[model samples]
Target: MPEKNVPTSPPTCPTDLSLIDSTYPVGVPLTATYRLGFAFKTINLRLPVILTKIIDQLSRDKNEIGESCGQEARDDVKIVVGALAKFKNEMVTNKPIYKTGCKIWDSYLEHIAQLYFEGVVEDVKWYFAPWLHVECYFYKRIHDAFQLSNHLKSFDPFRKQKEDGFECSKKSSAQLAEYVLSSDSSDAVLQTLLEVGLWGNRCDLSLSSGEEVSQLGNLVDQLQGLRNFVLCDESANFWKILKDAKTANPDNPLTVGYVLDNAGFELFTDFCLADKLMDRVDRIDFYVKTTPWFISDALKTDFDWLIERMCSGDCSDFPVLVKLAERWKGYVLSKRWTVVESEFWTYPHAYFEMQDADPELYSTLTKHTHLIFKGDLNYRKLIGDVSWKPDTPFKDALRGFCPAPLLSLRTLKADCIAGLRAGLAEEIESKSQDWLVSGEYGIMQHAQ
Candidate 1:
């Protein structure tokens, strides 16, 4: 099939280089720079054909097709990578000029560029959609910096807060257990987990401690309504599956695998969900990225360091706090009775490439697994990160790609949401131009 179409016009580059040069200081906050960088990155990485569609749509003053929008957004990403690659080539002859961060960024850019040049873009586009691409870039940049700086890792802002959040949940899990036992409905556990999930999103560690605490409380309060909204057919089916699993093997532990996203409050929320699961099941395991200090939440596997930081009460250096919050949202939704780790995130290859680079992780995922892919990042991976029709069924969107049972629980943090009912796409368009791409709405799908 042809790649999804997108707009084609070249994005207007900022004339002032000073805008890019402005540094964010410790106290004075400026999110605009990052947002601009994100936009630029998005426009650069889009496929050329998709870019043409976007230009066509924009020229005609029509809404861009799903694929076109994705391509246009990613086009800037391509430019950024290209520029960095050029910078890297220049560095071979002109050393002592580029900063360590830039150098690392260049290396990652080169890797991505190679992927694009090798005609792997189509296969990997699903995995490297703009948001996921940005995330991967962020991690690689940090990894490169650490390598250059005597292997010194940076502090993640979310790590300490997430540890504290987990501890708090541990203390409250008994209370949650009491509530679960008192309420006879299976939805009780799901409801509590939903509240915990929302809290995870709000209690973002990137923000100040005070802000994080306040958001946590707010999310906790909103659980009752979210619970009511979740009483659909899927909810009923989920409970049925759980019941059958319990009946078949009373001694068998229910495994809840968390495809983790970001660190901090989200991580804390994930811990809370895990604690709650222990009330219903037998064991819990978590999977996280194996990289150094990249995205905050991916560092959850490094629990030892997180615990120490929480004890010392120092968490200020971690960047990408908002992304961490988004990932936490995914983490909260995946909890069940027992949790197990999935090593896919930590592996270097894409999901399709996993069979060769990390067959063990792939094999483990295919066996006795029900994956909860969290956030837009995982969604990109699940759907090959390519643009698809808005009305595509979730399973069809995956195109028979996934090997095991899986569900995508994502708040539309980025463009490229799929698996909508026929009119659902129209409804979103009529109500708000940004609805499909906005993070306000969510999707929950199961792949058998």
Candidate 2:
């Protein structure tokens, strides 16, 4: 078991959300006029366009796919293409989520059935469902389309974009890699690395409508410019947790775990940080998305692909990257670094719901010194995607979901937030009309 170094921060301002009131920015019934509404609409509509592009490319290059998987993959390609088009059309037309016998089908269906049993007439409608449920079902439905196919059960439509996104950020990766190795005080370097890890979140494909945005200019120098933008700064607390882990395990290095977010560039940045963490910890356990979820989320395959890319790809000009790649191979060989996949992550449920929904996963979470949740969706899950008043305490919103002392490193790409000081959210809103979705601001909150 990991030694506890939990912070003792009181709830910022305890605000109860259990009371029911159907209205926008306060409580239930998130409507079409809000940014959440528009963001969901844009993502749902944009995915089909992406799926078609993948299908077309696959159809044109069936021979290429066959060279690796087998000729039967051509038929699987056709199955996947047809299924993706059908799924896209269903969402575009507001068709009810269909049953596909997935593991979550019973729970999801029962939720809607119960909603209908109660008097919620718009029980299963896409826009009418809980924003979290709607979003969760959308990605699962996409995965189902591929899963029901023959040879393409594991095929990832978003794989190309993820790979391309990483390729595009090579310059940023190299700069951060070099900076990490530069001789500097341990505290300053750790602080810089944490901020770089935070900013790496700005490039999420889900927020950018499937586009790639690389980190720009000198990452270390850019930290001061981003300082004021971080609504909640807990980088120091996180470092303390890491240091405490080292203290606890004086004879052996502690293990750190990451509930990973986006793949490609963001994951490369995570690796840059993980590479540093490895020097102190016995290992780092990366919990990746079980499937190609939310488009650019890291899958087990993505982790494997990145290792291969670093080891064999022609981008050999980066000495830091190459050195890390070689070190990563040895770490893998020595069984010091490990990867895990859990369907619970890809499930539509919130973090608070995890202990009940998947106790096995929640039980596994307890082994880590700390679990670091990356990116916006995980943040949304942490807070249950509730419309809590801007100053609601982070732990208060957590609703007792803390499995271990944890940290959330997220850029504010969505409206749901908690743990800000009084008036901070309003102040941010007054200064910038769209602070939440602009990716200009961030949060590095810690909770015990």
Clashing pairs in 2: none
* TM-score for predicted model 1 compared with the true structure: 0.58
In model 2, which regions exceed 4 Å deviation?
Answer: 1-23, 29-40, 47-68, 112-122
Q: For residue 387, what is the lDDT in candidate 1? A: 49
Error of 1 at 303 (Å): 4.2
Model 1 stretches astray by more than 4 angstroms = 1-135, 151-186, 202-216, 224-235, 292-294, 301-352
- Backbone clash count for every predicted candidate, in the order shown: 37, 0
Each candidate's TM vs. the true structure? 0.58, 0.88
lDDT of 1 at 50: 26
User: What lDDT tens digits, residue by residue, belong to model 2 across residues 315-351?
Assistant: 6877777777787778877878789888889887888
Candidate 2 positional error at 253, Å: 4.8
lDDT for model 1: 0.44
